[model samples]
Target: RSLAESLDAELLMYLAQRRITPGFLNEIDLFLRGHPELAEYTPDFVRRFNNARPLAAYRFFLKGYTRPARYVPGILPERDDQITLPHELPSVASTVDDELVDFFDGYEYRYDILRRIDDQVRALCNFLRSGGRLTWTQRLLVGLTLFGNPVDAYKHYEYNYQTEWLPHRYLPEHVVLSEVPKEPDYSVPTARVRTLDGADDKTRHTFLNTRRKMARANDAGV
Candidate 1:
């Protein structure tokens, strides 16, 4: 049990460094729950893991960048601005080295490389969804590169931000009303007055002072 705990901690640290999505963590939790024998060893492991929310708090305390909405703002362009496929896409079979070929062959057992494939899978999904046309060869190459089961692919492609994982302060309407000032009235006399480009220094200073006073009054709710 002690050894398993230590190993799990190490794995969590590694996943944190790799910025693995919460969906992956949830899957792990579900797997653990399914096996009572394994769950017995780790005390409240799933609950504690969910509370820590490592995925949402990945790297910085900010939310995870795994959401498709965060990365893919809109339908991505079919091709680059040059109207050509990216150079990184493998062309001839020789373009892929033996080591990469071997990795793809045994990709099912390569959990360590999962983080690296996340972006590639996202790009492939976006490209396919955007009605981009890919040749049979191109599709085959991409499939080999991003080889994963339907579950893994679905988790990667449709990952959403888990609200419970985010910091409470980031929740909507959680902001302190007092700290957030109301919109100020823009009808101040100084704002209405337009100074000439070469206005005198005194005039400029007066204009600035009026603006500052208006801001202060608005902030003070006066």
Candidate 2:
């Protein structure tokens, strides 16, 4: 309830700026309050209501939210500004102070993350319409981090799946089909070529005779 209230407050503020009606807001608020379990797993619930504090935030929300909170939490970074997985490896430099990119790009690196990034983002936006709370794992998976990594890429999958205790979702069938190409191969030409090689006078003579015979046959037929 506490988490849902906070999310609803933030959502209402956002909607108001967009001129959303009071009736819609009230209905959304009611809907969020109705689904306590989903509320606890919604990304809007985490980002708006359960923003974990600094070092604690990094540990809890940023680093998988395993740490116990000792106090109130602060706001996490925005999605656009959030760190992404390294798209390219750094070139070699011999200098002592040259820094290398971190091995893990902050964006989701798993296959699942790639598949569900858009879907999770949409779901998060919808969840915000109602306002709710998301569990630590849910926050990591469904929030801005949804673009960070897919389900299969999570380091703590087995542990989280068995112990984290929440509704597990399968990858939608569309994900498997979306990136596929539909057109048949028409890029290359497929014509055949024939070659004639002359090796000796006898061979050339035989060819000439055959051609003459073919011409004679054609003339006779005509």
Candidate 3:
């Protein structure tokens, strides 16, 4: 294979193993511009990384740029408990790919997404409850935090749908989920999951403070 092909393969591999952030996407954007066809190799990429990455997480990068990732039609459910993947994808995808990915036959990718969000929400809430602040990494993942809401699901769906992607991605699932997920977990499953749902005074104070701050930041259109 050519250098472009080799680099493309490696890039997808690393991305599947790790998550991406908005700031880091500036780097990936440079990559995508140089290799605009990078999106074309997704089938093979997915085949290899299926056990290493969340389907929605990887799709966030392939949207618009790849033909396989067509707009999903109303798959979100009424509850935030699980993401109901469509029984099938748009057939137009087979024509666009250099190879077809038959891996996503059903809900194989569902658990990890909820697990990913659950993790982020836990991390954010933990920091708040402990009177601790969001780490640099946590701040970078602000988009993935704040779960238990219908809106969070909506944004996550849009982010995964196509190439008009968001930058708050790319951290390895292990880091995002805290611990590594065991076998058959996320495939990229994380380690020990932790949450800070304390009723302590300090926890309450910090939680309110951060919540208001987040509200204001959202109002400021962050």
Candidate 4:
């Protein structure tokens, strides 16, 4: 099938399974608005989604708990990334670099450093809520970040606090945890991860996504 059709299917599948984070709800609605047929195909999925919005205590999770959307790669830049640097260097580049070091450097939970990027996630979430259209790639990545494997991205990487783990961490009783009945699906391949190539997480703490439930490493030991 086409990518758009595949996305529509996966989108609904994720929604029906109650696998996505609250931050994903608005975009899921947008995808429906753009491609209305998916809703018609699974009316109950749409119905449940519409019914659940009012139940949310905070529509936008801006503080205290990190929004799962923050983990999507393009949404935020790495700390040392000069992409966000001023167009005109106000100070010597080397001097600026030396002064603002990564205090979270060598920190075990590097993903904790990600919570610092909450502003970007908030802005993007607000943008969607205001009727902005995101490219299909954005929606897909967000879907994976919010719903794919709510423990880790790849089967190989299982520790040091991955992005999907945050939703369960901050919002333990998240609305997305409720199970839904199975429905028709057009098979979509599981996203693959080849290697731990990036300079990522310092700690080895791990989690298991026990279907609708979140499982974590024991405090006593692995």
Best by lDDT: 1
Clashing pairs in 4: none
Which portions of model 4 miss their true places by more than 4 Å?
1-26, 55-76, 79-222
lDDT of 4 by residue, 1-222 (tens): 122233454444544444444345454344346645545565665565455433231221111122232233443333212123232322111121211122213435334333322233344445555766554444432333333432222111222233444433433222232332334883423223233775444353333243123223222122
Please give the CA lDDT of all the candidate structures.
Answer: 0.37, 0.34, 0.35, 0.34
Model 1, span 4-31: residue lDDT tens? 2333555466454433433444543443
17-58 per-residue lDDT for model 2 (tens digits):
433333443343453455454444455544643464322222
**Off by more than 4 A, model 3:** 1-30, 36-61, 64-107, 147-222
Cα TM-score per model: 0.22, 0.20, 0.25, 0.22
Candidate 4, 130: how far from true, in Å?
Answer: 43
TM-score winner, 3 or 4: 3
Q: RMSD, each candidate, Å?
A: 18.1, 25.3, 17.5, 17.7
